[model samples]
Target: MRIARLGPRGAEVPVVLHDDRAHDLRGIAPDVDGAFLGGGGLDRVRDALAAGDLPELEGADALRIGAPIARPGAVYCIGMNYAAHAAESGSAPPERLVMFMKSPNTVQGPDDDVEIPRGSVKTDWEVELGVVIGTRTSYLRSPEDAWAHIAGYVVADDLSERDWQLAESGGQWSKGKSAPGFCPTGPWLVTPDEIDARAVRLRSRVNGDPRQDSSTADLVFGIDRILYELSQVLVLDPGDLVLTGTPEGVALSGRFPYLAAGDVVELEIDGLGRQRHRFVAHEDAPEVAGA
Candidate 1:
């Protein structure tokens, strides 16, 4: 089943899609949060669908989609997990997993407008497979344990600003990655059973020109290995998001220009779904104290 959240940003409601129509699930579960996924909500949704107990969401196509899962506990990212991406960035295949975080506030609807930070150049796009955790996971004994802990997957655009990430803000990548609307994900959440999480084709286009095109099969560190490694260091809670890195051909490779205001970025992962976001400049955002 393809699960989605629809309506305005803060007031979105969860629904499940079937026969190309969305069926409201608010009556059976709350927004797609930790409590919902951790407490067997998907099972309940499937049972209700089997019983014809759900109401079709009227005009769902016209409704604005929020991120398929509500704000997760956190959004963890794998850096350069794809061999080609690492090579393109002039680095060797990582001896150990490289990781980072995007502030939870960066979460935005799949089609929302991304803002170009003030005084910025080198804003870029990364299309990656996003793994949504369904249960508490820690120190998993082996790679085989990964599938049991995953709830589903989503398409994620991991936007970044190179200057702040590599030069200005010391060497921390998240400094340039955590901008608002940087992580636009999900037109839908596809359950694990629906697709092969390890070998999907993921691609990205900027303003109708293709930038990245590759398969998850090229990942240097596959999903299961990533999970096995990460779980040893941190507790991945229910509803947490993990961006499994991106394949080659990002603007960072010096093969294309960086994203500018008015650019439209389209990202897709086969079987998961597609996402499109327009880029805009934030010229007058108010400053916060010490920001």
Candidate 2:
């Protein structure tokens, strides 16, 4: 099943997409959040749909599509998990995972405008496969155990400012990765039963021109291994987001120019859906509360 949220930012309504229509999920849960997922919300939603209890959500197509899940508690990212991406960044594929964190506040609607940080000159884009946690996970005994904790998958754009990430980070990448709206995610949260996750095509474009074109099958460390390795060091709770990493063809490869104001980025992963957003100058961008 495909789950989505649609409306103005911060006031979106949860819904299930089936038969090319949106079915209201307000009666089933408050929002498509951790409480809902960890509390058996999907099962309840399936039952309701089977019984014809969910009402059709009118005007859904005209509304903005918010990130499929509510604000995540944490946004974990894997860097250089793709061999080609590692080579592009001037590094050999790591024997261990290169992980980083993006503040949860970076989350934003899939189609929202992104701000180019003040005085920034190396802003870039990354198209990644995002995994959402459905249950509290810690110390799993095996990699296969990850399946039971996964809620679903979504498309994620891991926007970055390369200057701060490499030159001024003093060794930490989050400095460039944590800007507000740096993470634009989801047109839908597709359940595992509906996608292979291990072998889907993911691609990105800049101003309608192709940039990145790759597949999850190219990942050096697969989904199961990523989750299993993460569980050994930290706890991942429901609604937490894990970006499995982006493929090559980013500006960092020196093949394309970095993003500037007025540039549009489009990203898509087969089955999960697509996202498109524009970059605006910092002064012209909307003010983000508590940013």
Candidate 3:
């Protein structure tokens, strides 16, 4: 089942897609936040959908999609999890995973235009695989247990700024990452049961040229281990998003080109769906408090 939240940004209603038609469940009982994939929610909805219990959505074409998960408790990211990406930045693979946070407010619809922050010139992009957690979890010993916590997956573009990340009064990498509207995710949430993730190919392009090209098979820390490692320190709650880390071919990687104003960004993953957004100059934004 492909689950999505569609409509206007703040007013998106939960709906499920089957047979290439949208279904509106305006008052059904399933909320995208939780219970959509847990406590027999998917089964009940799937049965209802198969039995024709759901009606078609009113306006599918014009609806803007919100990030699939409703209210994520946190947005956890893995840094330098891809070898070539680490090498591109002229560093060695870390002894352990490097984790950081991107405030949940940064979440936006997959197609939303990324606002370049004021007084910034080094805005950049990273295409990553985002894992949505289905259940609450803590420390686990092995990789197998990690799979139990994941609800599904979606494509995420982890936008960034190079100057704030390294050259500024940097304390943590999150400084550059937590800017408003920095994370664009989810045209659709593809459940793990419906797709194969082990060897899936992922790619991202800036404007028309391909900038990032790599396979999940190249990840330094695979999905299972990442969850197990993270669970040790923080409790993984339902609706929390875990970015699986971007593969090689980002501006930090140095081989690919950097993003600039008016450049279009496109991210695609097999089965999960594709999402596109454009980058704009910081100076083009409206004058505000800091301006």
Which one wins on TM-score? Answer: 2
**lDDT values, one for every candidate:** 0.88, 0.94, 0.81
TM-scores of all predicted structures: 0.96, 0.98, 0.93
Highest lDDT: give the candidate number: 2
> Residue-wise lDDT of candidate 1 within 207-253, one digit each (tens)?
89888889999888889988889999999999999999988998889
lDDT of 3 at 178: 79
lDDT of 2 by residue, 144-254 (tens): 999999999999999999999999999999999988899999989999999999999999999999999999999999999999999999999999999999999999999
Query: What value does the lDDT take at residue 47 in candidate 2?
Result: 98
The local distance difference test score of model 3 is 0.81
Position 84, candidate 3: lDDT: 82
Stretches of model 1 off by over 4 angstroms after superposition: 284-291
Which candidate model has the greater TM-score, 1 or 3?
1
lDDT of 3 by residue, 1-291 (tens): 888888766678778888888887665754577655556566677788878989998878678877777767799999988888888778898779899998888888788777788777778888899998888879888889988888889889888888887788367888889787788988888888888776788898888788888888888999998999999999988788999888778877666656777888999988899899877776664332100
Summing lDDT over every window of 10 consecutive residues in candidate 1, give the lowest-scoring window: 282-291
